[model samples]
Target: MGLEVERVNEIAARVAASSGLEVVEVDMRGSGNKRMLRIFIDKPGGVTHEDCANVSRELGTILDVEDVIPGGSYVLEVSSPGLDRKLSRPADFQRFVGSRVKLTTRNPVNGNRYFEGRLESFQDGRLTLELGAPKKKVKAGDSAPQKVEMDLSNVEKANLVPEI
Candidate 1:
């Protein structure tokens, strides 16, 4: 099953790249009656509906020609990582520089297990963030928020917390 899944992703990536889409992730799920193949795609300008449709069409042919999955049938789904996409690598952390992020850590840091702030920069395998909340003020407007800094390893999962 693992080998089959890996091969499917390889074929899917080749096909998707041919169409200008970066294949971010791929996985096969479910059993006998409910097998599903999910593919996550992305690009510099971000993925579009048209991107999914085109990758689907192109990948459909490649999958058929390769005969990668000889099983009865499986569902294929292609999509973007979306706004709150998960960050699993140092590269991912670097990619999201300047965006506000919320992260969960496996162990406590500064007596807490979570951190939220603006991702300032990523260098030398380390990440920097400026954290705090806006101040509330009757005379000025709002109070200054607190600031915090944490290491990337302390991060179990992180995502871009879009401006609401």
Candidate 2:
């Protein structure tokens, strides 16, 4: 279950990169008898159904050639990340600037640890976010980034919150 998914993800990544797209995320699940592998991808132009189809065809051939999946019957699903992307990498934070994000910390901060706010910046292992409070502006290269200091280890989970 685990290694097969990783292998599929690796194949999806290679095929996407070769096709000028970015592999977003991959999910592998089972329905008691069948397995489903969902591969998400994105790019500067966003991703279309055609893109997913193309990746599915190509990566499918690659996976079959590699025999990553055994005799277990499975279905392959290729998709896009949509608006709510799981923030896993520092690069994910940078990609989501100017958007609302929900984050939980490893330990509490300011009586409550969970935060949902406007993502400001991510640079040099630092993430600065403006919580939904009184609008206090902070200039570039100032104390604002310091106040929002959160060690990467403190990030338990992060997701782009839908602004609606």
Candidate 3:
């Protein structure tokens, strides 16, 4: 039987928590015999190959016993969120402060929908970014460019700019 999306997420979250991990995302693609389920997991330090293997083994058994999926022959993949992990929640933005981020706004901010800079601060559902300095400054000693302040509601997508 095909489980509802919410039910799948709930079950995945429960399983992940019991295994000392958090489910960052769950994506199901294709259908019928070609179904694929990809689960992103994370922890304080990081996840190893063993961690992925363990979660896959345990979750697979649980799903099989529960009959959560509708069809046959589906692939389940469990792994770390990775270096360029997507920022999907408010906590994600807060946790990644001081890191480089590439973001797109739902509407233009400063006549632009795209922005790439160092995340300076995130508070009260707002984001501040240091976009570096402009090439020309009026005086010998002019301040570096002012930070860009944006509301969280305006963000369409954001991702950590991987260092390497």
Candidate 4:
């Protein structure tokens, strides 16, 4: 199943690249006839409905012809990563510097595992975040640091915080 998923990812990346798109993520879920394959794509400006439809049409046909999926049937979905998109790669962190983000670390930093702040910079596999103001009033002795730094490997999960 893992190999099949990797093959689908490779194929999706190839198809997306041919169309001038970047494959953000490929996910497979469920089993047998109920399996689902989801591919998220993006580009410099953004992704359009036509882009999604075209990739879906082309990739779907290829998957059918290649038999990349072992199951009897599976659903393929193609779309853009939304505004609050995930940040999983180093490039993703670098590209979104200065944007607000929310993340969880694999291990606690300062005894806290969750953080939300503006991405100050990403360099040398490390990121520095400028912590946002507290949601509630802060006590004099409870002030948090203005900034925090951590290695990229420590980020268990991260996502852009949509700025409205």
Best by TM-score: 4
Cα lDDT, all candidates? 0.78, 0.80, 0.84, 0.92
The collision pairs in model 3 are none
On TM-score, who's better, 1 or 4? 4
For candidate 1, write residues 1-164 as lDDT tens digits.
Answer: 79888897888788778887777778789877588888889888898999998888777777777777776787888899888887777878888899888888888665666678888888867777777553223247643336556677778888888787
For 1-164, candidate 3 gives per-residue lDDT tens digits of 23545667788788888879888888888888888898998887888898888888888888888888855889899989989889978988998999988888999886667778899999999999988544344467755446789999999999888886
Residue-level lDDT tens digits of model 2 in 44-154:
768889999999999888887878888756788898887777888877888888889888888976545777788888877778778775235555674422246576667
Count of clashing residue pairs in every prediction: 8, 0, 0, 0
Candidate 4 C-alpha lDDT tens digits along 7-118:
9889999999999998999999998799889999999889999999999999999999998886599989999999999999998999999999999999988767888999
Candidate 2 TM-score, true structure as reference: 0.83
If ranked by TM-score, best first, what sequence of candidates would result? 4, 3, 2, 1
| Cα displacement (Å) at residue 104, model 1 | 1.2
TM-score of each: 0.80, 0.83, 0.87, 0.95
Top-down lDDT ranking? 4, 3, 2, 1
Candidate 2 or 4, higher lDDT?
A: 4
TM-score of 3: 0.87
Prediction 4 TM-score vs. true: 0.95
> Residue 138 of model 3: what lDDT?
41
Worst 10 residues of 4 by lDDT: 133-142
